[model samples]
Target chain A: MSVLVYTENWNGKFKKLSFELASYASRLAEMLNMDPIAVSIGQVDRDELEKLAGYGIKKMIAIENDALKQFDTQTYTKVIADIASRESAKLLVLANNNAGKSLAPRLSVRLKAAVASGVGQLPEKLSPFVIKKRVFSGNALAGLELRTETKIITLAQNSFDLIEKPADMVIEKAEADLAGIAPKTSIKDVQIQTGKLLLSDAEIVVSGGRGMKSPDNWGPIEELAGLLNGATACSRPVSDEGWRPHEEHTGQTGKIIAPNLYFAIGISGATQHLAGISASKYIVAINNDKDAPIFEAAQYGIVGDATKVLPKLVEALRKAKSA
Target chain B: MNILVCISQVPDTTTKVKFTDNNTRLDTTGIQWVINPWDELSLTRALELKDDASSGVAKVSVALVGPVSTEPTIRKALAIGADDAYRVDTEALDAYQVAAQLAEVVKAGSFDIILCGIESSDYNGSNVGGMLAEFLNYPSVSGISNLDVKDGQVQVSREIDGGKEMIALPTPFVGIVQKGIAKEPRIAAMRGIMMARKKPIQIVESAPVEPLSQTLAFEPPQPRPACNFIDPDNPEQLITLLQNEAKVI
Candidate 1:
């Protein structure tokens, strides 16, 4: 039996998330005493496929088909399910991102496999296939056990570290039979957000809230984000007031992010807001109120006006980077 | 066209997460239950579509897999403008069981459009819609930010990594909606709240599907350490701490 990892690529290049999935699958494969195999469905080159070897993937299946270029959910599910059946994959792993979230559930139903989505850590035990995952919007955790023989797991991004265990890998080309299959949905148009860091993929996020007082006072927030090469975000109230786009809202009803460093400037962290950002590794809050709830969740805080502290902090960071 | 919006009742967003029964179950004492924020938005969008006479949406209904105790939450959905509601008579266990039970309801109703939240705030499973679609053998579009129906044709838009894709599909599809589906969830007025009492709520028997996964235990997140305060006078000290102590920058 083999542990199958789906390494999705963007325009023939693999992102850090793919390697993280491979690393997670490799570790799980070790625990199960199974081979770690990777499957790539897009037009990834051989060199790109070989990178999985560093994560202990011994074999890679590369499927390049014109019909599979645009990523139809149904077609991709069929292709992956076909591969799993052929390889006798006992466990399948995917990233808990947009694509993975779309694919894992359909695959679970198709394969009759038990699925545990948004799994945050490695299994606590392998005998009964016990794993832990975030629940209640990151406010709590739940330990779950899969009772089915075939299991599917979607790894939460940035929750697992990338560990390198080098192995000699072989890449094989395969063809998917798409004779009777047609995409159920048709893509009419595509619009790609350009020239700005996406909040969901950013490593650092600088977010503002109602305490900014007005949309006109957003200069320092943007400047700080530009300096850190991070993305800009806001609270739900700010978005509702039309101070920022709804896409920039990071809260329970908005986008949930897990950046490495989250700067909550001029924001009193409400529980709903904290639910979206609590997964952030380091939280820094700058608020005039010393007892703001954000400070409770923040690792470091400055009890001062954000307008006064932001420019000075930006200058200090500029000097530090230059030095 | 009939639209079915799947809703789940969860603890209010501000409720403190606590466990009971040796950490195996959620404590129910003094906890206020509400329709999940995402599902509320989905119901709002479904009602919006139905409200537009040109949209050709005839009715909006809601389905939930919960016990009789959750009827109040279902009534809340009805008050928000769902024409009717269906409650599968079972406590929601895992995503699979919920999806299976919901599939039975959908098969019986034969709704043209099905709407579901991307994830519930409580379990955050993010699974039911796709699994339900698979169980029904219907096409599904996940992460839908914009959904519209014109002359009985459905169009949806969803965000990809750095892009947005607009999709055109036939009816009898599942739409896993997210934040932008509605500007804000609609609030029920006094008249609507009163009328909701007269709306029909059909309780369907639970399906025989066994749950594939079981929750063994629950635990609150580790308490964060006390915040390290930096003097407001020396703004540079915060940067120093970020560089040397936290090392995030």
Candidate 2:
């Protein structure tokens, strides 16, 4: 009967996406004439869940289960599907994170509700079940309407800004009957990737191609990405040539990213590579070829050797930072 | 080893897409549909595993949960390399719905390994493989950059934040292949293309599954203004423009 947000916690503190989802669901609740309730799964004490009241959530549902300590897609999905149905939630909102992406689709099927992922904005009151999302890797926006009785939606990363606000809310702890799923997937070890920006999570990305010549010369790309607090990516040719890891390749066949700023270094601007990055908000291509297709897509094109242009750009940024 | 590779047809990348008369349907005016790119990678890897295995023989079968129009792509998958193929006749494009139907088929077939593209180029949801594995109570991994199957176990290397995590799962699992898993996939040869004609393709009616979301209309992305070209030889001018106009600097 209300809008519910599955809040996320890391090391006893709420993840940034949780506040973002609560802030987002608050707007949706206002549209549906219902309250937005924040649900915290696992061993979150009442005090910890209640502290989320500062994010404008009117109510909190805390489910305490030791099994929920680590994420098992099946157990999490079962709990969410049960809660959504039992809570009589009209709409379920989640951040399109590792957990949310894995859980939302299954919950949708179990609840017979429409599920939307990579959702951007809430629907205008025109229809309660309508939502807008980025399609074709942010190349287009689509308004999708779910005609079902219940709906589930996953918001894309960085699309909705987290609100800094406080709320007066109620906290309720309910340990529902176990979803009957013993975790089959075990984390042999949690290797936290450190010392670099995550390509998928980065807002600003600087990528190179064979134009960088070799991996040894990749210091500039890494340095620039570091300065911007971004990630370093590469084209398919670079990966195939063994200059960079295949995971760094981004294109139609590679990872499709839609960062706020995409800086291409030495890429020939082939359509295949551009397919992955066309979704970027602002694309700046540096290549010697003025006729490169990437230039056509670039908001601004620099027709120069990437090696030469890159250093100057990095130098300029370093000086700007110092100033 | 019985491997089931799921392929989905999606609009070709770079296709200028728009909404149909109603927004729910995609307008195919100038657009050409192709096998999902990630699925193509999955297909390529599946074909490789089939070739490498000596005893298990890696019986590779391609399956798609879509309408008859998707068969051309299924045939394309056959051309790439597959022993047999299956398609559940349905017009549903939702990934979760497709996953449910796939689970029903897999339950009947009892495939030892499942392969899918990490994500479709069109929807880019990247959740189907994980959802399907969860539905069947099987171990699943997504965004795998490289994979191999041996000793009735599967090893997957997927890209994480900085490096890669190499994990092992039992045979009854799903592996979603990402791009860069292989270099330029070889187009089907004439013999392969001719052989694809004979591969048995069983079309089963899709069972009903609840859809999680609906699409009202497709909105094209905001157009970028014409590119501002800088003189190639002039380094200072380019630097000035990048700092003042492009603002990346």
Highest-DockQ candidate: 1
- How much is the lDDT of residue B224 in candidate 1? 92
Q: Estimate, for each residue in A83-113, the C-alpha lDDT of model 2 and write its tens digit.
A: 7777789889987765576677667656666
Please give the TM-score that candidate 1 achieves against the real structure.
0.96
DockQ (0 to 1) for model 2: 0.47
Question: CA lDDT of A80 in candidate 2?
Answer: 77
Q: Could you tell me how far off, in angstroms, the CA of residue A30 lies in candidate 1 after the best superposition?
A: 0.7
What TM-score does chain A of model 2 get? Answer: 0.85
Query: What tier of docking accuracy does candidate 1 attain?
Result: medium
**lDDT, candidate 2, B141-224, per-residue tens:** 666677767767566766555556676666788876776676667589989899999999998778887755556677776677
Q: RMSD to the native, candidate 1?
A: 1.8
RMSD of each: 1.8, 3.9
Give each prediction's DockQ, rounded to 2 decimals: 0.70, 0.47
Backbone clashes in model 1, listed as residue pairs: none
TM-score of each: 0.96, 0.86
- Pull out the clashing pairs in model 2: A1-A88, A114-B212, A114-B213, A115-B212, A115-B213, A143-B216, A144-B215, A144-B216, B23-B216, B23-B217
Candidate 1 Cα errors over 4 Å, as ranges: A319-323, B231-249
